[model samples]
Target: MGEELKVIVFSLAHEQYGVEVEKVRTIERMQPLTRVPKTPAFVKGVINLRGVVVPVIDLRGRFGLPEADYTDNSRIIIVAVKDMEVGMIVDMANDVVDVDSDNIEQPPEIVGGIKAKYLRGLAKLQDDRLLVLLNLEEVLNKSEIVQLEQFGE
Candidate 1:
C-alpha cells in the first residue's frame, strides 16, 4: 500500500487546495479581525483566540486573486509554523481527506498564478477532483513569518 497524507481540503474561488492535517491547529468560523497597517494585502489582520492574538491572512489575496466578501461559508484555518500560530482565511473549508503519496505529482511551473514552490504536490482524486497541496512554510517566506510572529507581541 502506498503512503497517505492526511490533508485538510479548502476551496478558494472554484479551485480546491489542501494542507497537511498535522500542521493545522484548529478550524474556526468567521471572526472579527483587528486590521494591521502596512502589512501585505493577504495579511488581513489579527484575531483573538482565547485571549491569544493570532495573525490572520487571506489566502485568496496571497495568491493574487480578487478579494471576495466573507460569507456564511467562509472559515479561518489556524495552523502552526515553526513556533508561531497563523490563521488563513479560506472561502470554504471542505474536507479532511487522504491523498495517496504515489498519486501526488509535482506541481507545474505555475498553478493558477501561485508559485510552484508554495505547493507540495498535486493529487488527482476520484471523480476528476484535483487537489493542490500547499507547502505551509513556503507559503510565507522567512521574512513574512517573522512579521507574523511579531504581530502577537
Candidate 2:
C-alpha cells in the first residue's frame, strides 16, 4: 500500500484545496474580525478565539480571487505551520480525506490562480476530482508568520 496522507479539504472560489491535516489546528465558523490597517490586503485582520488573538487571511484575496460576501458556508480554517497560527477564511470546510501519496502528482505552473510554489502537489481523487495540496510554509511567508506570532504575544 502506498503511504497515506490525511488532508483537510476546503473550498475557495469553487475550487477544491487541501492542506495537510497535521497543519490544521482547527476549523472554525465565521467570526467578526478586527481590521488592522497598513497590512497586506490579503490579511483580513485578527480574530479573538478563546483568548488568543489570531491573524486572519482571506484565501480569496491571498490567491488573487475576487472577494465575495461571507455566506453561511463560509468558515475559518486555523492552520499552524512552524509554530505560527493563522486563520484562513475559506468558502467552505468540506471533507477530511485520506489521499495516497503515490496518487499525488506534481503541480503545473499554476493551479486555480495560485502559484505552484504555494502548492505541495495535486492529488487525484475519485470522480476525476483534484485536490490541490498546499505547502503551508510557502503559503504563508516568513514575514506573515512573524506578524501573526506578534499578535499572539
Candidate 3:
C-alpha cells in the first residue's frame, strides 16, 4: 500500500471528479453571485463567502459543456491555489474518499470532454468507478488567477 490521498469528489454532468482535500477551503450551498463584466464565460463571477469575496468558475462552463440550471444539489467548492482562493460551481459535491496513491495514473488526452491539461490523473476506484482528478493550476492558470485577484480588490 502507498500513501493515502484524501480526495473531495464532486460531480459534473454525471461524471465524477476529485480534488485534493488540502486545497479545499470549504464547500457551500449555491448562493447568490455578483457577476463580473468582461471575464471569461467560465468565470461565473464572485461570491461573498463570509467576509471575503471569492471568484467562482462554473466547472461545466469551464469544460465547455452546455449550461444547465442550478438545482438543490448545486454547490460552490472553494479551492486555494498559491495565494488566491476561488470557488468552483459544481453540479454536486457529495463525497470524500481515501484513494491509494498507487491507484492514480496519468490522464488520457481527454476525459468527459475536458482536456488532459486541466486534469492531474485518473484514479481507479473500487467497483470499476473512475475519478477524474483535476490539476487546479492548469484549470486556473496564473494569468487567470491574476484576473480574478483584481475582482477581490
Candidate 4:
C-alpha cells in the first residue's frame, strides 16, 4: 500500500477539522480585513497577502455555527484550489496529522444538518477525537463568491 495522506488540522467552534496538507500553502496570522458589501455573511472580507488580494472566509459562520471571537490563536489558512488562492479563518490551527486511507471514513449522511458533499471524509484519531476532513473546493465554491466578483466589476 502507498503512504498515508497528511493533513493540516485546525479547530473551529471547538470542533476539529482538517484539509489536505498539499492544499494548504501556508498559515498566517489574521490581518486587517476589508469588508465587501453584499457578499455572504460567512465571507469575512478580503486581505492583501504579499500584493495578492485574497478573500477570507470564516469557517465558523460558513458551517452555520455561531460566530467566534478571534483570539491569539486565530489564523488564516491559505489553501490553493485549482488556480485560486483562498484564505480560511479558523479559531486555531492544530497540527499536521498523518492518517492511512483506511482510517478515514466517508462522512456520515448527516452532520448537524451539514451536507456530506462538503466533506471529503472523517478521520478518527488515536485520541478518540474526530476530524471532519473538508472538501476545500466545494466548501468555498458558492454562488456568492461569484456574485461578489460581479459586484466589484
Candidate 5:
C-alpha cells in the first residue's frame, strides 16, 4: 500500500486530467473575463473572484489543442502552486477520486497532444483507465508564474 492521493479530475478535449485536491481552491462556472494585453493567447484574462482578481488560462489553448466553444459544462478550476493562484478553464470538472500513489507511472513522451514537460505522470486506475496528472509547477513555468503574479498586484 502507498499514500492515497485525492485528485480533482477534469476533462480537456475529452481527455481526463488530474490535479491534487490540496492544490485546488474552488471550481467555478464560466464567467465573463477581463482581457489583458500582451499576454499569450492561452492566457484568457482575469476574473473578479470574490474581490480578488484571478488570472485564467485555457488549458486547451495551453496544450495547443483546437479551441472549442464553451458550454454549460465549462468550468474554471482555481488552483494554487506555491504562492500563485490561477484559474484553469476546462471542458468540464466533475469528479473527485482517491488514487494510490503507487499506481502512478512515468508519463510517456506525449499524451493526447500535450507535451511530457507539462505532465507529472499517468495514474492507472481501476477498469484500465488512465488519469493524466499535471505538473502545475511546470504548467505555469517560472516566467508565467511571474506574469500571473503581476496580475494580482
Candidate 6:
C-alpha cells in the first residue's frame, strides 16, 4: 500500500470530517466577527487577523445543517484555497490523523445533504468512526472566493 495521507480531522454536529493537513494553515478559537451584508447566510462575516481581513464561513450553515451554539470546542480552521486564505468555523477541531489510501472510500451520495462534488473522500478510522474528507478547492471554489474579494472591494 502507498503511504497514508495525514489529515486534520474535525467534528460538525455529530459527524466527523477531515481535510488534508497540507491545506490547513492553522486552527484558532472562534473570535469576534464583523458581519457582511448581502452575502450568503453561510458567509458569517470577516475577521481581522494580523491586519489581514479574512472572511469566515460557517461550515454547518454551508452544509445546510442546523446552526450550532458555539462552545469551548468551537474553532475556526484557516485554510489556503488557491492563493487566498479563508477561515471556516466548525463545531470542534479534532487532531491530525493518518489514513491509508485503501481505507479512503468514495463519498456517498447522501452526506447530511452535502453534495458529492464538494467532498474528497470518506475515511474510516480505527474506532469505527467516519471522517468526511474534504476537497478544499471544491469546498471553497474560486467563484466564492472571488465574490468575497468583490465584497471587500
The TM-score values for the models, in the order shown, are 0.96, 0.95, 0.97, 0.90, 0.98, 0.94
RMSD of every candidate to native, in Å, equals 1.0, 1.1, 0.8, 2.0, 0.7, 1.3
Per-residue accuracy of model 4 over 13-131 as CA lDDT, tens digit each: 77788999999989999889999887788988888888788888898888888887898999999988766777999999999988777778899976755678889889887788888
Segments of candidate 3 deviating more than 4 angstroms? none
RMSD of 1: 1.0
Off by over 4 Å in 1: none
Report lDDT (CA) for all predictions: 0.92, 0.89, 0.94, 0.83, 0.94, 0.87
Worst 10 residues of 1 by lDDT: 140-149
Deviation in Å, model 6, residue 76 alpha carbon = 0.2
Clashing pairs in 2: none
TM-score of 3: 0.97
- C-alpha RMSD (angstroms) for model 4: 2.0
Task: Give the top-scoring candidate (lDDT).
Answer: 5
lDDT score, candidate 3, position 141:
91
Return the lDDT, model 3, position 94.
72
Give the better candidate number (1 or 4) by lDDT: 1
- Tell me the tens digit of each residue's lDDT in model 3 across 1-153: 879999999989999999999999999999999999999999989999889999999989989988889999999999999989999999999799998999999999999789999999999987678999999999999998989999989
Evaluated at residue 28, the lDDT of candidate 6 is: 90
lDDT per residue (tens digit) for residues 5-37 in model 1: 899999998899999999999999999999999
- Over 4 Å off, model 6: 151-153
Cα lDDT tens digits for candidate 2, 4-42: 999999999889999988888899999889998878899
| Distance from true location, Cα of 86 in model 2, Å | 0.6
Arrange candidates by TM-score, highest first: which order?
5, 3, 1, 2, 6, 4
Give residue 10's error in model 2 in angstroms: 0.8
Off by over 4 Å in 4: 148-153
